[model samples]
Target chain A: EAGVTQSPRYAVLQEGQAVSFWCDPISGHDTLYWYQQPRDQGPQLLVYFRDEAVIDNSQLPSDRFSAVRPKGTNSTLKIQSAKQGDTATYLCASSSDSYNNQAPLFGEGTRLSVL
Target chain B: GDSVTQTEGLVTLTEGLPVMLNCTYQTIYSNPFLFWYVQHLNESPRLLLKSFTDNKRTEHQGFHATLHKSSSSFHLQKSSAQLSDSALYYCALMRGSALGRLHFGAGTQLIVIP
Candidate 1:
């Protein structure tokens, strides 16, 4: 079984630029999540979805950050007009259980640097 | 809301010494799942140990953690530290009702020296 896969392992962007990160969850996984992890800090939940419906996105920055899992198996996280403060690693995780009763498996993450 | 706290920012210990990382959590739900994740350099975070039962010990890869609902604590421990154990550890909590969302601590970086 393959693990969660994320694209563009790394990215470098300037202020006011737009960037998008992609994620593919594990097979048969019903729950997917996106997290932002800054240097020396823990992973913070940005948003999550169960199948095609969003479960929670309260932590997401609506003005600049947006995420969607249209078909429920893949997801895309986009940042509009990025700022220096947006520099961080974006992690994608998935759980096999629909209710997320199991521990999540994480991807290598996309390291983004905004200058 | 659920939250986790790791009191230690960094812990340095020599090989063969005991290791202990403190973790505490706050949550309104009585049944909360606690998890410990380890991330090595340039790697993704993986689950080290997890437990939802109170007063029960969960062990994985020579590391152990016991969830104590009475005190709202779940501390990671190991008898002897190894150089390979150097990494960042995060303690996380998930409310019983809100299963998929995880609230993580700031993290503790453990450096095991020879």
Candidate 2:
């Protein structure tokens, strides 16, 4: 089975520009998550969903960040007017169920740079 | 607010020695789950172990962590270190709910020198 897959393994955009990263989770996984990992820090959950319904997005910057999992299988995380602070590796992960935080499979992640 | 802490930002140990990584957590939720994740350079973080039962040791890939609810700690430990064990380890905590989102610590970088 294929693990999570992400596009544009590397992305570089100028400040104030916009960029969107896509994620394809593992087959049959019902939970998907988007995380922002700044350098030297752990991956922080920005948003997560179960079967296309967002469970929580409080950590996401309302003004500049948005994530969607329309089909519950693939997700997109978009950054509007990207700032230097938005520069980090965006990771997408998925779990088999919604009950446990057991082990989540991750993609290679999209390394974004705002210059 | 819920949070996780890793005291050691970096640890260097000679190969064949035991490895210990300290992890502590604080959460208001009564039922909390703890986890340990390993991230290699330029790769995404992967789960190393998780805590569901109190005082129950969870082991994976030669790494183990015991969740002590009394102390609210889930520290990762390995019997012996290997060069391959060098990586960044993150401690995480989550509530068993609809959210199920994990709150992670800053992470500890382990370096096993030959």
Candidate 3:
């Protein structure tokens, strides 16, 4: 089975610029998640959706970050104004089920650098 | 609130040595699932092993870990280290009540030397 796929494997942007990351999850997966991984750190959950409805987004920066999964299969995460601190890897993951036993499959991740 | 802690930032061991990376977690729920993910350079993190049953050991790819609820720990261990075992390892927790969220620790980098 094909795994989760993400576009623009790397991105470099200046401060105050806007950038968007796209994700295409595995077929038939019902849960999709976006995570931010800073250097030398583990992935931190940013937002998640289940079948086009956002389940949790409390960790998302409301002022600048927004994510949408209109079709329940593909997702887009946007950063309105990027800062240097925003430099990190953006990972997309999907799971066949919501249960804890089903481990999520991860994408290659997009590495973003804000200058 | 759920969180995971991996005390070791870096572990260096010679090939053929036993390996152990400490992991501990805190969660309000008792039946939380613990997972170990390994990420090689330039690759996505993949599941190494996971266990939800307290005190039951789960083994995969020569690595094993047991969820000890009494101690609130799930430390990854291997009988012998291999040069190919060098990678970044992360301990994660999935709350039984939470559907799809995973709380991850700060990760541990393991280096197997010859």
TM-score of 1: 0.95
Tens digit per residue, CA lDDT, model 3, B49-70: 9888888999999999999999
lDDT (10s digit) by residue, model 1, range B1-114: 678899999999999999999999998899888999999988889989988899989999999999999999999999999999999999988876455488889899999999
lDDT by residue for model 2 (B1-94), tens:
8989899999999999999999999988877878898999988988789876899999999999999999999999999999999999989888
| Model 3 CA lDDT for position B27 | 89
lDDT of each: 0.91, 0.88, 0.92
Model 1, global lDDT: 0.91
- TM-scores of the candidates are 0.95, 0.93, 0.94
Better lDDT candidate (2, 3):
3
lDDT of 3 at B65: 96
Model 1 docking category:
medium
- Residue pairs that clash (backbone atoms under 3 angstroms), model 3: none
Q: Report the Cα lDDT for residue B66, model 1.
A: 98
